[model samples]
Target: MHHSLSTGTPLRVQDMHKRFGQFAALDGVSLDVKGGELVCLLGPSGCGKTTLLRCIAGLERQDGGVIHIGSRDVSRLPPQARDYGILFQSYALFPNLTVEQNVAYGLTGASREEARRRVGEMLELVGLAGSEKKYPGQLSGGQQQRVAMARALAPSPSLLLLDEPMSALDARVREHLCGELRQLQKRLGITTLMVTHNQDEAMLMADRIAVMNHGKVEQYGTAQEIYSAPATPFVAEFVGQGNWLPFERGADGHARVGGLSLRLHGERAAIAHGRIFCRPEAIGVNPTVHEENLFRAQVREITFLGNRCRMSFELNELPGHALLAELAPERMPHLASPDIWVSLPPHSLQVFA
Candidate 1:
């Protein structure tokens, strides 16, 4: 793990609200990104992730609420007055100017000599030291993104805002740059907020992820926390691969699904009828009799997903519901029969009320 310099100034947002006519883009959105931490605003389209980022950057004014960068109240300030750097999805580089000029554009009060030095330093930091003379049109998509990042980091702003900065690149390029961007953020120790619809991208780069939906944050937690134990039904369905099956409270006080009464894990949820969710990887196929929560299932479909194979199983008692199991390629031999026994780990099941 990379260590960050503690600045003690977190990005605080309180009761933020934004609206476009009758449609509410953001409603009571609040997040506190600790200094030197990279927090990602992640969700599907129309989830207000981009709108919240724009509001934080002062490009789109919030209809209500306050945004505090460090200790400063930047809610009502113009974009230029706020001490923050922004990187857009388009990699908003100047095609008319060279890379060096573009990176130095934010150094408003710095002397010419100082600006030149800063530009050189930034270009080198982004691995484009010798390409300072290249225009945006001359560079590849990845290179243009690097230039944009360099420009954002040049001024050493108190906060950094990234709005889908790598969405336009190829998958391979995006994956490669995601690691580089995480490393850069750790090394710089700058407070950063990134808005992205890509779950893989957010999982790869964010220190903490704020899962948003319909103008609100549904859940905020570390990657493992969000993946392993989702806070809401929406988070369970959206964050990662999981099987969400409708389960009703049986007369025995256990969750009843697929005509099977199974022992509930953790405390019982408040709602009687909801979903019982668990990750595909947590379910075991054909485990020994010593294991608990065994079920009779038939393999309905098989999907080859590169490193792992996804096996969709239909419960013998509940033919309408399907449970997906992500098994490693080596486990193929263990799943030879369609009517195989499956075990749901006791600790893996979560009730979404």
Candidate 2:
């Protein structure tokens, strides 16, 4: 990586909007990415995450909004005119060209000797040091991906745009390369924006997550914040595995969860109607010690998932409603019976309106 590229500049997208005929792809989207920060645009399909990335990369022209890299406005510029590096999910490497050539292709502006040096450095940076002479077909999936990364970074751009870069790889390989990618991004100090629908991937690699829905940014915060304090009902259900139970506002300005009345958190507590969402792990299963928010339920289903067991229970008070709880394997010994009591911590139940 070049010395100048190591010090990333800030990125700002203000009130971005894009449309394809009758359908809106991006609607009033705005985001801020600090220097050397990694932000993931996470959402389900048709949520406009990739569209936002393309707008930022200048691959797609937005109908309205301003995009700034540091202090420059390059929204109108074409993709090649902008000073940024991009990595596609396909690992778009040339089959005919050797790894060395693919990496050096971006270094057209540098002297021959300088380009060679940069190519070697980039390959080494991505852990593909001496395999430069081999073609993309000769390398493994992970290695080919690395070569694509090397090619992108060889030019030393300030911003790195990744469009589902790891979605094509196998689970194990994707996990391993995700770790490497995070480390390399930190080491090089590049401002990165990645688009991934995978929740785990976003949680593992991003400093902050931008959850989008229907071409709008639903919430923007750290992974913990997005997961624990979702701003909208869509965010609560989309970001992680959770249960959204029917909820109604109490006359006392609290929330009624089945038979229990608990105080809601944040601004949603004031809303009239919504669902109270809670994660399976947040619901305690037959606690060893007594705790608040305890509720009685009967087990409806059980699933063994490695170190933890996922058990579904139907709330005794709320007919036709079920809650999922994940407990350790040791806790399942006594929980084998259908009769079980679970506790929902007040803090874990987020009222989404």
Candidate 1: tens digits of C-alpha lDDT, residues 1-353: 24456962589998899999999999899999998999999999999999999998899999998999888999999999989889998998888999989999989989999999999989888889988787889999999999999999898889999999999999999999999998998888888899998999999999899999999999999998899878888888888888887888876547888678777765763458888888999998987555777888999988999999999998787787788999898888877789988888768889876
Give candidate 2's whole-model lDDT: 0.89
Worst ten-residue run, lDDT, model 2?
Answer: 1-10
lDDT of 2 by residue, 1-353 (tens): 33343378889999999999999999999999998999999999999999999999988999999999988899898888788999999999999999999999888779989988989888899988999799999999999999999999989897999999999999999999999999999888899999999999999999999999999999999999988878888888887789887777886557786686766655657878778889999998888898666768899989999999998888788767877888898887897678877888777877756
TM-score of 1: 0.96
In model 1, what lDDT does residue 112 have?
94
Candidate 1 runs further than 4 Å off: 1-3, 269-271
Instruction: Estimate the TM-score of every prediction.
Output: 0.96, 0.94
